[model samples]
Target chain A: MQRVPELLVEFYSRPGYLAIIRHMIDTLCGRLGFTPAESSQVCLAVDEALCNVIRHGYDSAPDGRIRLAVHEYSEKGRLEILIEDDAKQVDLDTIRSRDLEDVRPGGLGVHLINEIMDDAVYEHRKEGGMRLLMWKRLPRTAEPAKANQEVDAGES
Target chain B: MQGNHEMQVNTEQRDGATIVRPEGDVDLSSSSTLRTSLQEAHESTEGKLIIDLANVKYMDSSGVATLVECLQLSRRSGTTLLLCQLHERVLSVFQIARLDGVFDIVPSLDEALAH
Candidate 1:
């Protein structure tokens, strides 16, 4: 029933915030006992979401604050991350995928975000801001290969 | 917030490869450095262009997109572009983007040098 653990942060939407996000995930997941692959996926998805805010929400102006929260739902077997910014709101529907064949150098953040997370959604907060809600289910069992290895070791 | 940082780029032609060495993070703020290095290498060399990312500890979609641009440029200019020594986090970015298949990724500088 503990779906909302107290995790929150607020910072300027600057490029440097990327590293802070990475470190936060590492520390939080370490405490939660996440597997390496799960930790990596979460880190990547958070990066994609924050990068969108930094890129589109602020429009590289660096004058607004980004509010980020991570709620660990241990009982529900899921983790949720929410990112919001008070700058010029991004109309998420207007976002488009870059032509993979064109090989250009821009506009692929949304695609990466959609690819990494289990459920990704964007909404316009009633208070005039852009909010991104992302959720993923934590695996209920240990990796089969690792579990098998542990059993084999016990037998030996 | 991580401290503000800049990127340094270097280009050298050795053993039939144009090696572009960039030192620093490759997020939105610093991808321009990668662009400059890749462009400089392509202009100067008619051979393969190898991007040595050994010193690059961080990168975002902007950085990977820059590499994709460089790959396209290499194709148009008839030069091969290779990426080597990608740090684990940087590699993870590529994997999430599903771009690992698009680039010639090698384990080390020596392996890239041979190709």
Candidate 2:
């Protein structure tokens, strides 16, 4: 049996590199049973997490390293992602999403992750830096309704 | 219709509004460029500033933040800012943030121009 594909990558914390990561996640999510819209949200969540790592964890230091690991459990219909940065650790409690009613420009990254992902948590890595663990509930199959419609059309 | 070759966003003055259009993905790196364009549009236009998102297929939180900043700037300067032609995907980001109500969103450039 072919094994499930996993993504384990480490790269410098740079804004330019985010597009590559976003593309990877969007493609992987689509192949793993997410609709295009769902894939976009998942991709955005990951992008926002990486942005946080670069902005808050690394203090915009381009030389810092960011480790990203993505795992999938097809049977459980879940996708797990871990984003770690080798920069200053954060106080987990302080990483709160801004109040949406405030109508502001900044502080929406954490809110987006929490809104899109099924589960998201922040923790300080004992070794150094901070780690963000995120979980997304993947669809068991991509566009079941469309598949049913196609089958129905064929039978008729 | 005209564009800055170095940036993803293009700007044009049509009717009474300065229309700023950004193509492709808007993320951390591109949001700054988008912000600059929006700010300039707001500053140069005494009538209205409209952002046409017809070509923007993907946008992240940073892009949303940039728009919010532009909205605030437009309000502060007494310039009317409108967003039009948002893709369903890009529009969802604003809906998720509940910003759909905060900005003046129109269905097309004509609607924005009319507003």
Candidate 3:
């Protein structure tokens, strides 16, 4: 196992905390040499996962606690993220993205997360709640500085 | 990343359509505001509805859901809902959900209004 730098964050499972969580993910990915586009994709996937934990996992109660663990394995060129919540165990079989033909609101979050991340697995914690494990392969030719410059140029 | 701030929605009448421009990130925390604004636009306007997403850099499922609701409202009321100038990141979210084909998405606001 390669030694990877990890970041752990704990917060109340509230919608308001999404901003901070997004910032942390952005910074972590930026440090890991992910390009702007890749960083945004990862952030969006994690954001959707966390939203699921808050909305479905905790039933939108805003009383439960959520923990996010992010690990960057530079040697393996992989990024791993885990989202844990002590609310309810998700029925893996029932957790399918809705049919696009339906064209309705809700149920799109899971699909977006599954599409952006390389791998996503859900496990019911023995103690309580559920844990979501998501992984992404960091591009080997990540040019963080150039990506930043491009974003800056776009903004200007 | 844009700071944690409430979403700001501004509405205007443009070329026989209601143009709603929401600035800042749209997520679970701020989707309701957009929802209310869109509802108001739907009620007040008989013409088409255009949403300019140029300034919205990030949008999650909640935001998408809100738009879906707006689309439903538009259809029921015989109004057309068009989205314009979607940021790349936001557009990717729509594409991932396979909503890109369902919604009337255009490249720019002028184009959306023209159609």
Candidate 4:
């Protein structure tokens, strides 16, 4: 395996900062040659993961610091995203999407992250806090055909 | 950056249902606004509740959770919850979570209104 280029961003754990994080992910996905739809999916998955860190890990405190890194291996056509927070360690064993049969609010973040990303892993940092690692394999050939479908739908 | 991005929600009565249109991205930051709007619409109307997602380009699990909340409320109150105009991206979120079968999804406002 070869070392990939990485982009790192550190921000306060606050809901307001989600937009900035989403924008950063969007730009990184675009540079990786992901279609608009795929880029949006990647952004959404990252956004959900970060939100879980802020709400669950940090307990909604804005003072906690969140470090996000995006690594792209162009040769391998893979992307890795890591989100680290200095909050309490989360029990990875208990992280599961709630039963959809019982519809209700909350408990969907973990499920969405798992569904969108190719692989999702939560780890307790040896030093402190927790780290969430998510990976996505870019399609061999980007689908540009469906990129314009949203535009056409909007105009109709 | 506290209020950089906000979700806009508008409600209108269509036929016998309440149409709730949310514009912009619906993530963690804006999910509360959407939840409050949906709650109010659910409480005020005795008819169907239609969520038009045509303008929502992006939504995360928080947004999905909010909709799930509304769906549960509708079932309890015997009100129909119909979702229409789901963007391909937004719809995929529902499908990935295996929620597409849980909610009544329609392709357009007309179909939602028809039921």
TM-score against native, each model: 0.82, 0.89, 0.90, 0.87
Q: Model 1 segments beyond 4 Å from truth? A: A1-5, A96-102, A139-156, B1-8
Please list the Cα RMSD from the true structure of every candidate, rounded to 1 decimal place.
Answer: 7.7, 7.0, 6.8, 8.4
Any idea what lDDT model 2 has? Answer: 0.83
DockQ leader = 3
Pitting candidate 1 against candidate 2, the one with the higher TM-score is: 2
Q: Between the candidate structures 2 and 3, which one is better when assessed by lDDT?
A: 3
- What lDDT score belongs to each candidate, Candidate 1 first? 0.76, 0.83, 0.86, 0.83
Kindly give the number of clashing pairs for every candidate. Answer: 0, 0, 0, 0
Fnat for each predicted structure, in order: 0.57, 0.70, 0.95, 0.84
For residues B1-115, what per-residue lDDT tens digits would candidate 1 score against the true structure?
Answer: 1223477888888887878998877777778777887787789987788899988877778888899889888888888888999988778878767788888999899999898
Clash-forming residue pairs, model 4: none
After best superposition, candidate 1 residue A94: deviation in angstroms? 2.4
Cα distance off (Å), candidate 2, residue A102: 0.4
User: How does candidate 4 score on lDDT?
Assistant: 0.83
True contacts kept of 3: 0.95
TM-score of 1: 0.82
What interface RMSD do all candidates show, one decimal each? Answer: 3.5, 5.1, 1.0, 3.9
Query: Candidate 4 lDDT, tens digit per residue, B1-115?
Result: 1122667999999788899999888888898999999999988787899999988878888888889889989988999999999988889889888889999999999999998
In model 3, state the lDDT of residue B24. 87
Please provide, for model 3 over A5-80, each residue's C-alpha lDDT reduced to its tens digit, 9 standing for 90 to 100: 3678899989998988898888878877787777888888998998988888888998899989886655567788
